[model samples]
Target: MDGLYEQFRIALHQVWQRRWLAMAVAWCVAFAGWVAIALLPNSYEAKAKLFVAFDNMVPTAAAASQNPQNDIMRLKQTLTSNENLTRVVRRTDLNKLVTSDAALGGVVAGLRQRIAVVAQPDSLFEITATSSFAGLSNAENARTSAAIVQQLVELVTSGQLAGDPQRTQQSLTFLDEELRRREQQLQEAEQRRMEFEQRYMGMLPGTGTVADRMAAARTELAQLEQTIVAARSAVNAMRGQLAATPATVPIPGAENAYAGTASGQLAGLEVQLSQYLGRGFTEQHPDVISLRSQIARLGPQAAQERSRGSAAGNGIPNPSHVSLRAMMSEREAQLAAAESRRAQLQADLAQLGQRDSAQPGAAAEQARLTRDYDVLRQQYDRLLADREQLRLRSDMQTQASAMVVRVVEAPRAPSGPTSPNRPLFLTIVLVLAIGAGIAAAFLKGQLQTTFPTANRLASVTGLPVLGAVGEVVGRAERTRRRQRLVWLVGSGGALAASYAALMAAEMLQRGPVA
Candidate 1:
């Protein structure tokens, strides 16, 4: 512990004795460092914050285009693109210095590093531009930073707004041309269908495909055959009932001829005809016409025999038998009509089948035509929808969804240099200079051959030294030493004062003088 204290004391004395050298070195280092720091170009930075909101007012088309992240990504790319940087160079005072293509390219390359675009959540963008351009004043660089940021934003905004309309118009034109082509195709298909039907009108069915009509006709033909069979069975049942019942009931005092009169038979036939009419059989029905013919044939005979049939109340008409015969006639007529319909339907189906077999490619050709028409129709409809959407987008206001950038904070010239941190750096340099000077003085003291302490001398020489004595000086010498001390103190104070001055100068600076 004693040795350490002794060494510390020796070091303090060494520093004090070389104080003048330390002051000179400190002054030189501080001044040189301050000059170098001052000579470095100041980097002025401008910053802007923007808010982007998308409001696509078009109907039903916003869903596919509502991606804010993609829009923000595009904004980032556009902001730093070469085209935007080129525009920035032209719009700012930087253009004056960059006359040649090489100069412009170099400036644009430098601008790439200087500009920064940061995208934040909730559609916020932070745009920062820095300028450390040479041959320009710090104030000019500060202004240029703001101008470049503004120009970049303007370029991006104008680009998004302007390019959309032209592209939309082009799309609309293309869709229109496609629609016309599709329309022409649709007409040609219709013409082909018409000509095909006309050429094979006798064989091919109208209003439906041959197969569909054939299937339908076959189904109906089967149903008609079933109806005909059922009707024939019903007519046979009625005939059996008529066979069981006699046409007339005989009485005790009448002749057999007198029992069955012509009037009564005619009346029975007329009654049957009336029943057929009441049952919704039209006058044009075969049964109804046949009954009318029979009535006509029997009318004159019945007129002559009416009195004889009245006189003989011997035979009376059986109503049940008459009714059965009338019903049988109606059923037989229906069966005949069904048979006729079945024959006609069979003939039509045969013709369709034969036509299809003869042509062999009719169904395939029709199928291909239908398929082509359907495909073209679907494509035309899709293009129509797309065209409508494009029209909506084209009709948007000048500053529409894509041009939604809002200047939350406009870019402005910086009041101070962003880099170099001058005041702090100046203080660091001052401290380092002072430290270097102290180190130099300490090294010089160590280089000397003399030793201030007896122990130090003894340790070095490996000899025994008893002690050391202090120097006794006259009052005048002491005064002289005091004067030297004051000079040394003043020199150090001046160095400190210069450091303070540099710091003050740095702090007082708002920006470069214009």
Candidate 2:
């Protein structure tokens, strides 16, 4: 510890002996540092405060429950977007100053680097822009910063700016069109479902398992059996009535009456021909031609039958037999139709039984169809609900009843440059210059092998020094030393003068301080 202290003392003494050289080195370093600082452009910063209030005229439960932090973040991103930056550039002199496309891009990129957005307490946000250009005047720097902030404010306030209210409206319109298209799709789906139900009828997979379908089919079959029984009873009753009536009823002019009706038959044929013509069938159609020929043949036959009836002088046979035959024919047709319906019901019942026997296959198919129908139905319903919610949101937006951005503090021009902090920079440069000077002095001392102190001499020679010699200066030597001091002083003054001139030139170029 004592040795370290002694070494430190010796180093201090050596530094003191060459103090002028140290001072000169320090001065040169400090001058260079100050000149570099002067050459640096001034940076001016402008700041604005924004109080983001989530104000809405008609606040919904959803909107009110939203996180304001997320909205604030989104707002920050919007302000920093390239589109907003381009607007800021256009509003200032940057647009004209930038020449080519690449230069403009570089300018925009540099501007983005100078901007900062910070969220403070109490829902307030701060936007700061720093403007600095090579050889820029203090007033120009301040003006640029102010312009950038002003353009940012305009972008935030104007809804027509890109990715703001215009985007919101476009999204709403797109959703509206999508909703309409979905509605059309839903209507078409419903139509298809109704048609399918009509075509399949009872066979449709409706609200039950296969067992339920089987039970329904059995019930339908029972009902059809009862209808068949009723129809058979009616047929039997009609047969009994025919059986009770005589097969032939005596009528004085029955035969002649039947023969005389030929004229009415010919009139019926003419009516049939007219009906075919009205049905859009041409006369060349097989059915139309056949009807015409039948009418032509019937006309002559009717005339002959009428003449024979007139010559015989007999009234037409009793019309009761004709009436009985027509009644029997109608009953037989009804019985046949009823039997056919019963057979169809029986066939449907058999199909249901077969499907029940093949339970796995039938059940899988039924499940698949049911699942598909249910999925589509659910999707349709969900889309309907979403459309309703979208409509409410779109209405809210259209009415300007949603959260909005409002500026609490407007931007103003800065009074002075915020950067290059000349005092602090100069202080740091002075410290570093002193340190460098000390290092250079120690380095110069180390290069010489001669002992700088008595302790170093003793340590190297292993001998105790009792005395030290002091050189006495001659007259000529003294004059030479004095002349050398004058030369150094003159050189220092010249350096000082040059530094001052450089400072003056820089100050003149920067213009008067604002």
Candidate 3:
């Protein structure tokens, strides 16, 4: 602590010795600092605030998915997009103002860092912009801020759906197209249903729906009846031929021969049948004798057939009866079937006539088709009605689009310069000057080869500083008195110089009196 005090004392003495140089340096530094502050560009800042409102009146159930806060955020992003910014730049003519001077342009570029956009906790925003200029007026700053707000309003509200006029028209156009398509499809489907109904009018599978089937059956039955008539004519022709034929006798020359032929023919039949003895004929013994007598009578015809055996190609002795009976039976069955078919045809034809008379007329069918078509047309009309209603809603919306923002509190010109903070600058400069003064005192001490204490001198030179007196007390006392006088004079001179500079600056700004 002692050594430090001694060092300080020595530094103070050195500085006092070079007081003129020290003062010159201090004045130079002060002037330089003042010049730097004067050359700095002047700057001004402007700020504005806006309050957002959500004015939709629809009920929550109708728009359950909507979030008003999210909508506001979306709007905020749109306001800041490049597209909106470009519009803002053009409308405010910012480029013109910013580029008019190089310094202003630099200030504009720096504004990106200085400008602030803040959203308050409760859905409000504060927008601020800063501009720097050499000699800007307060009115100019106010005008710039007002213009920026106007441009922002335009950029934000021009295309917010509520302001667009074309949306309603587009919706109407789309609805018209869809309505047309539905109408066409309905017409085609109706036409196809009518054609199908006409082609299959009465040929349906159910018995109750068989009008066409009955007609077809009647026609088929008529054709078969004609065929039966042809068959009956053939039967009559055969009967006529049978009636014109005469019976032949095997023994025609003598009556006795005839009778003997009959008896002999019967006996031959009896003798041929006797080849099989009846095991159960005991009770019918006389009946068997009578059958023998009858067979003996037809034996002559058997003998006649035997005489003509060479002409009989089939070995069966009596094929005439079997072939004639089979042909007769087949003709009878065919005739019966034809008659049955005719009866069935008559019944079916009667049923068809009844059904035809019972069915509704073409007028009624057409009315039914028209009724169905009207129903579909009504449905389509209802849909169109709904769409038209929505279109009216859209049209109304277009007429009442969202409002653009207007200023609640317009910007006003500030009274004071925002830049060149004088109090802060003065404080900083005074502190720096004191530090420089201390440095000068220390540097002077080092350059003068001065020793702070006797011990230091002895230690440095390896010699005793005999009777080293501190600061040469008598000289110091005189210097102290001299220093008091010098400080008074020097401070007075600095005050005069500063007052002169201030007067010059003020004069330059005010100009000479008229």
lDDT scores in order: 0.77, 0.69, 0.56
TM-score of 1: 0.51
RMSD of 3: 23.3
lDDT of 3: 0.56
For model 2, name the residue pairs that clash: 253-315, 253-316, 253-317, 254-316, 254-317, 254-318, 255-317, 256-316, 257-315, 257-316
Residue 483, candidate 3: Cα error in Å is 9.8
Of candidates 3 and 1, the better by TM-score: 1
TM-scores for every candidate against the unseen true structure: 0.51, 0.52, 0.41
Off-target runs (Cα >4 Å) in candidate 3 are 60-115, 133-409, 452-455, 468-514
Off by over 4 Å in 2: 1-9, 16-28, 31-39, 59-62, 65-71, 81-83, 100-106, 134-138, 157-160, 169-394, 400-408, 486-513
Tell me model 1's lDDT, rounded to 2 decimals: 0.77
lDDT of 3 by residue, 279-355 (tens): 45642577667766666565566557547752132223234445445566677788888888777667656755665
Q: lDDT per residue, candidate 1, 1-514, as tens digits?
A: 9878988899889988888888888988998999999887889999888888877655455445445676567568656767667777888988877979998999999989988889887788888999998867777888898998888767655554234455557878999999899888878887877776665444433356556656667788889988988998888877756654556654556655553776656757766876786689998999989998988997788666545565246566767878888888888888999999888878777776787789989877777776777787788788888887666545553335545677888888788889878888888888988898889889999999878888788989999998788899999999999999998889888878887887788767653532
Superior by lDDT: candidate 2 or candidate 3:
2
The 10 consecutive residues of candidate 3 with the worst lDDT sum are 242-251
